[model samples]
Target: MSETILPELPQELWRAGKLELAHGVQQFLQVMRVASAGLGQYLAEIESRGVKDLYGYGTTISWFADIAGLSMGEARPYVNRAIDLNPTRALDGTEIPPFAPATGAAAAEGAIGAERIKQILEILRQIPAEVSVEDREHAEAKLAGLARDAGPRQVSDLGEQVLGWLDPDGKEPKDPEPAQPRRELTLQRRKDGYWNLKGLLDDEAGARTAAALEAYAKPRPVDEFGQADLRTKAERQGDAWVDLVDLAIACPDQPGTNGYRTLVHVTIGLEELKTGLGTACLDFVGTMTAREARLAACDCLMLPVVLNAAGEPLDVGRLRRFVTPGQRRALNIRDRGCTFPGCHRRPKNCHAHHIHHWADGGPTDLRNLTLLCSFHHRLIHHGDWQVRMAADGLPEFIPPQYLDPLQRTRRNTLI
Candidate 1:
């Protein structure tokens, strides 16, 4: 193949008119498309020769990710695109054609962009296996030709039309037996300190879950401050899930292991728990911030196993931190709901937070305890907010200096 030199940027680019700038951008995009196609050819050759042989990496995508300073997920698409658009060699030295030769050709000419190419390739892949080879090729060619002038969405719409014309009826299931229900769930933690939850449930299970979540996910009533829940539907659902987990843990009938109620156990240093400045180990899971551990420990939502410098269990304080039922009822009667100003969270949705933490020798009585919703509970722990009992035997919050320079104390009048 002959080398093609790319054009240099126009001199005094800052002085270019609007139309000229638009024309320049179009020209540069065409150059990029051509270059992308050329890169795919090189990548195909590398794969054919064996990436392990050349770079000592197990996979071309992995090596590319490392060399290009990209995440594995970001690098995968480029490598996949290359393999799908370029010819490869079989182990027996036979030539294996690209999956969509017509699309690849259009991509090479810079007549289509990457998104359009992806749409065309996906359309080609969806063609029924039982369809004739000639029909598949014709469909692929038509999609690619349309992609040259149309957007990806238009190309996709045309492709779907072609598919409907070719097959008319969808593929029939091979098995005569009725399909079985499928239910699956996956929860994974990433290095960036976030958890990904994905799941699929059968119809019966799905309906039950939707009902449960919807019950708790309803928007909060307008508060004294005129603010509604303000959380999006998705955020409300997430909070509802947390509430459901809290309820399950608080249930007496919930299953247990090793003679203890099913609950998250956090192993934290005594200093970390006190100062909220280090990390803590979440039993059987991973790690959490010391501040979070402090918050989790305040209410024993996660039972804390406090450690000394020698890594010995200095204090478990599981039973000692627990507020008695009598005390909880009194707390609910007095405080009613979340003590945070304007919060409307009810007793069931709130955690009994120790004003002076139980770990710090604070009593578990009503005066020392207050009800706080999960959001306010986290805010009180992580943000500059403060909460305390008043002279009138009620819980009140003090806004940070920024919110109120005088730092005036406020009560939940809404309750």
Candidate 2:
């Protein structure tokens, strides 16, 4: 072919009308598609000649990456596309047809871009392996025809419908089971003392976990201060997991807790416990802020051991910190559920939270406590929410100014 040449654009190129500008851009893209097909053909020739022996590279993709300045990720699809579109000669010197002849022709003529080609190839791949060769070819041709007019997304949607037509039941033969169940989990402590968790649960476990988490993971209601749940789904799920662990530990019949429903032991200095500042040791494994220790101390979710500054055990007098059963029953009847505005948690799902933390010398009386779910309990301690007993002897919440410019007192109406 004669060498293709182009004249330089006039400075007025930028002043072109909308239709002219759009048409020029479209033509350029078509040129790119044609060049891509030519590149694919070259790559296929390299592959046929043996990539390693011809270019001292392990794979044709590696050679393309080095020469074309593309990353291996970008080069891999090009190499595969070439193999799928280009005919090859067998060892017996017989010709083998391209896997997708219609797609190859369209790509060579610049009628489809790389993305459309990829979508067509993917549809062809989904054809049942046991289907006759003619059926597979028909699917490929149909998809290529659709690609000529539709975008990749539309082509993909059509592919799904095609599957149902090809296999009405959409059921494939089950493969043999592997040696072990495909569930795995990894928890490792980082250098910063935080634990990183990664895991994969099998289908049943995953579904159960998802259902439980979703039960506790609804979006927080907009507080009276106009603050909605600002947390992302991931953050909500993390909080849900914490709630799940607490629920498991709170189960009276749980086997491993040795009659203590709590799972962790937090040891804090008497000063830290009272002041809500400073650090506390956690099960001798790591440390937590005294504020966190105070939260855990509430409802006695974590066994707390008070210590003097000298690291000696200190008697913290009578453990009147926990609300008595009768006091909890009264609070349950009074608050009904989480006293946070718009919260729908029931009484059974609540913790009797001390309005004034008991660690701060607040008494655990009916007037001093309110019912809060595990999520709201943590929010009262760690978030910007404030709670108090109203003059009428009922619990009320005060949203932070950011949530409510007026910072007005709000009551949960869900009860």
Candidate 3:
């Protein structure tokens, strides 16, 4: 029982990072990737058979989380993946089913759990291979309701729908142009308290950016319990998100920021502070990163740009001169990370967004400055969404017409 230590490497490692450090990081990443894949498979197993045999079965996700060394929310996905990767029984109701090979169904549904896998597989088999993830996901969701009562008739109907999806004669290959490329995000709030966000990003840029933000907003590990005499939905989802975040950060591809819990989120009221306007902080849902909150709090959450009426572009908020060391310390308590609608990013992943920028005649007080993770900040700067202060001084989000034809503006109290 002796301690294990690596032989010392030569000093004067490159300024970027030591070669040994780089190698070690790479090795760790490889291990993590392999582990994540295996974990997905295991979660497939758990979803079918309740965690009853597992130590934390009928209780809180916290117990399982302890074993994974992840937050309760984070652990849930592993459990779900275990469930989703391979359902307890395959379509024949005999041996558990596995996704059709190479369809990538295992990876996606696994994150949600076996139940979702079943739906995904059903939808995938029905649709042609060419269908997009978004379309497939939507179809799966619609069909999910029949899982309990699925019979031969339903199965046959699904097969027909899939055939139609495959051919879709006379239609262009289902590739919708990538979402609009975002260049900047400018949000404007009216005196009525509604805000609008608009911006731009090219395909690769927008996707990568979206991926980065989603890396944090995934649901936590709370999926095990359910409405049928299980834990509350909030608790289950929260755990899934927590677990997902931990897993994402530990992975090789993540931004590798930290201190997610410490950042401060401020919701400025445009009405209270402005002329009868409102303010709101960012929203953390689906994906969130704890690491992003630690290292670059200022850059992580607060968005620096704004827009005016007539869809004009303006750069009002700037975190550079505004975030004092002491103020940053206060900010940690104020903003956990990017303060965008339906986004969950840590401070390190966010930027110190200002309701008003000092450069644009904005005040440095908490009344104006807030947090927004990089993506949301950009969403604030470029996307067709909106953010503004509420009566209570909180951030709100309004989806673009494409996401919701109704184009409703929404708000959240949590940053």
Sort by TM-score, best first: 2, 1, 3
Worst 10 residues of 1 by lDDT: 254-263
Write the residue-wise lDDT of candidate 3 on 74-140 in tens digits: 7775564444444465435566554433222423322222343445465555466677766766555
Candidate with the greatest TM-score versus the true structure: 2
Q: Could you tell me the lDDT of residue 351 within candidate 2?
A: 74
Query: Which scores higher on lDDT, 1 or 2?
Result: 1
Q: Model 1, range 296-338, lDDT digits (tens) per residue? A: 7666545668899999997784645676667777877888888
Weakest ten-residue segment in model 2 by summed lDDT: 1-10
- The 0-to-1 C-alpha lDDT of every candidate, in the order given, reads 0.82, 0.80, 0.49
Candidate 1 Cα outliers beyond 4 Å, as residue runs: 1-8, 12-19, 34-109, 129-142, 174-254, 257-294, 301-318, 324-338, 342-350, 373-375, 378-384, 390-393, 412-415
lDDT: the better of candidates 2 and 3? 2
User: Which sections of candidate 3 miss by over 4 Å?
Assistant: 1-320, 404-407, 412-415
Index of the highest-lDDT prediction? 1
User: What is the lDDT, from 0 to 100, of the residue 381 in candidate 1?
Assistant: 83
Model 1 collision count: 0
Model 3 CA lDDT for position 40: 61
Clashing pairs in 2: 225-403, 225-404
